[model samples]
Every structure is written in structure tokens, then in C-alpha cells.
Target: MQEMKAEIATKNSKKANLLDHNSLKHILDESVSEIVTSRGYAEDVRMSNVRLFIGTIIIVIALFAQFYKKKFPGNRDFLIGCIVLYIVFNVILQLISYTKEKNAIMFTYPPPGSVTSTGLVVSSKLPRFSDLYTLSIVSADPKSISAGKPVEFTKSVTQWFTKDGVLVEGLFWKDVGALIDDYAAVPKKKK
Candidate 1:
């Protein structure tokens, strides 16, 4: 536990500065599509995880029904229903994932949870995933809405991921933060 805390503390200590709503908008406008693309990849991962979890639960329930058939009067019918439900659930999840993937390919106005009054309170933090680490950015403040929202962006920053991927070790945050800061510094052109 102490070791875990120490690791997390170290990661947090190395985090980049937060960019507010205007900064984020500037970055989005001027920067390449890589950030949006990364968001798509992250969404894909999130949806896959959801599918895996729910599928596992469904399978487990079906297995239980099979094993304890004598306990349930309509075991066969329940199993059939589970199979149908699983199929329907998967189809719906797939359609949703497809839509999100397609939408992510293009820039969208007023990101989810946008607010005129509060705007956005942005943050970038390194969150622990088991023994690995990921950088999570909350561009829109979930508190602005009654129901909270998930992180707006996330990317793996583990040693292997950093080594093999585009992000370099020790300078990952600097690279990403630079893009935002640089863009945010530029004056907007009059239309």
C-alpha cells in the first residue's frame, strides 16, 4: 500500500498544468486531430470494457441457471431468454460504439456537459490502473451538471506504452501541455 501511494504521489508530482475552457477551445481549434483521435480510441476501450463486464455477468448467470436447473422451474426458458438478451445487448452496444467512433472523427461543437454560466474547469491527472498508469483529462467540469460525467480524455502513460507509443517518457505531459499552452497563447483571428 505504501509503495502504491509512493508511486501515485510521484506521478501526481510530475503532472502538467491544467488548461481552462478557453485554453481547451484554443487547443482544439489550432491543434491537429490527434487529440480527438485519441479520444476515439479511449472511447473504444471504455465501451469494450463495458461489454466485457456485462457479457461476463450474463454468462455467469446463464451458467448458474444451467448448473442449478432443478432449482428453477423454467430453467430452459430462462437460459433462452438470457441468450436473446445477450444478443440484443451486444447489438445495441455495438451500434452505440459505432456511432461514437464515427462522431469522434469530426470536431463537435459544445462538448457534452458544456455550460454558459460556469464554462469548464479543466484538469489533467495521472490515474493509477492496477500497476499501470494513465493520464486522464477532465476538460468539462462534471460538477456543472447534476449528474457527473467521466473523464474527457485518457491515454496510457505506462513505461511500455510510452516507450512504444508517440508519447515519450519523462516529457509526455510537457509535449501535450505545450500544445495546449502554445495554442492558447495565440490571438484569435477576426472573421
Candidate 2:
């Protein structure tokens, strides 16, 4: 009878162990899912911000151009040229943002190390402006590259700003990574 009782106790312990293992697995799976979803969301936010920033700059330029044209009606040709240039510049910018947005949407399940073609790097540390400029030099001048080309200048600038911002805020590397990720994952509406 004692031996039977021992056997039963061992079986119960084994069952408990199995349950614990399953529970632990479940918790781990949940944590992983949360992290992935959060990262994706952050990326989306960052992309959106990029779109907004670019859009805002284009709008500001357009407004300024309009102001200039109004202030100098005599140079109609120059004003028209400025307006055309602004429109072309913005259209190209929108196209780039659209492409990035499409890429982000297409990759619904990005692996942890999945390198984005857009050079979206999330860092918990912000580098200085000079550091950013150095990186930009290494990445090549984005401004020099045609607007239609897949350039890394914006990404370099973003990385630089992110590094600087994090340092100023005295945030941790992980927090900086999260911030950068958020910046890159900005929401973009359909063109």
C-alpha cells in the first residue's frame, strides 16, 4: 500500500511539472508576441513621423514660395519656377514615403534581425550632430542622390537625431531604441 501511495504521489508531481512547463511556455510565448507587436507598432509610428516631417517641410516650403511670389510679382517667371520646383520636390518625397509605407505593410511578421531596406535602425543611444554628419558622410550624401533613388541619408539623419535626443533626455539604450523605433513607425495614409 505504501509503494502504491508513493507511485501516485510521483505521478501527481510529474503532472504538476508538466503543467508548470506548459505555463512557463505560455508566458514566454505571450511575452515574445508582445515584444514583436510593440516593435512593429513602433516601426509603424516612426514611418508615419517621417511622412509627416517630410510633408510638413514640403508644405512650409510651398507656403514660403507663395509668400515670395506675392511679395515679388515682377519676377513672375522665377515665382512660377519656384512653385514648380516645390511641387516636383514634394511629389517625389510623397512617392518615397509611399514606397516605405508599402514595404512596412507588406512585412507583417518581421523577424527580430530583419534588416529593413529603408535602413531603419532603432537605438537606445543618440549620437551627436557631428557624429550624425560623420555617419551621413559614410552613408553618402542623400541630398546629392536623386530623389527617386533609395538613399540612406534620411536614415542616417534620424539615427543621429535619435542618438542626440536620447542622450539629452538621459534615457536608457532600450528606451532610446523604443523611441527610435517609434519614430520610424509613423503611420502613413494612402496616397
Query: In lDDT terms, how accurate is model 1?
Result: 0.42
lDDT score for residue 163 of model 2: 23
**lDDT of the candidates, in the order given:** 0.42, 0.40
81-156: candidate 2 lDDT, tens digit per residue: 7688778878877787565443222112233564432323221111333222110101112243211122122222
- Residue ranges of candidate 1 with Cα displaced over 4 Å: 1-64, 71-74, 101-170, 182-191
Residue 171, model 2, lDDT: 24
Query: Candidate 1 residues 1-191, lDDT tens each?
Result: 99999788566442221223333333332232345334221222444467678678767756765686455565767767777876776776677656533223232223344332222223333332232232223323246542223334344334323221222323544455544344223346699
Candidate that would win on lDDT: 1
| lDDT, model 2 | 0.40
Q: What is the TM-score of each candidate against the true structure?
A: 0.34, 0.31
Number of residue pairs clashing in candidate 1, backbone atoms closer than 3 angstroms, sequence gap of 3 or more or interchain: 0
List the lowest-lDDT window of 10 residues for candidate 2. Answer: 132-141
Error of 1 at 191 (Å): 7.0
Q: Which TM-score value belongs to model 1?
A: 0.34
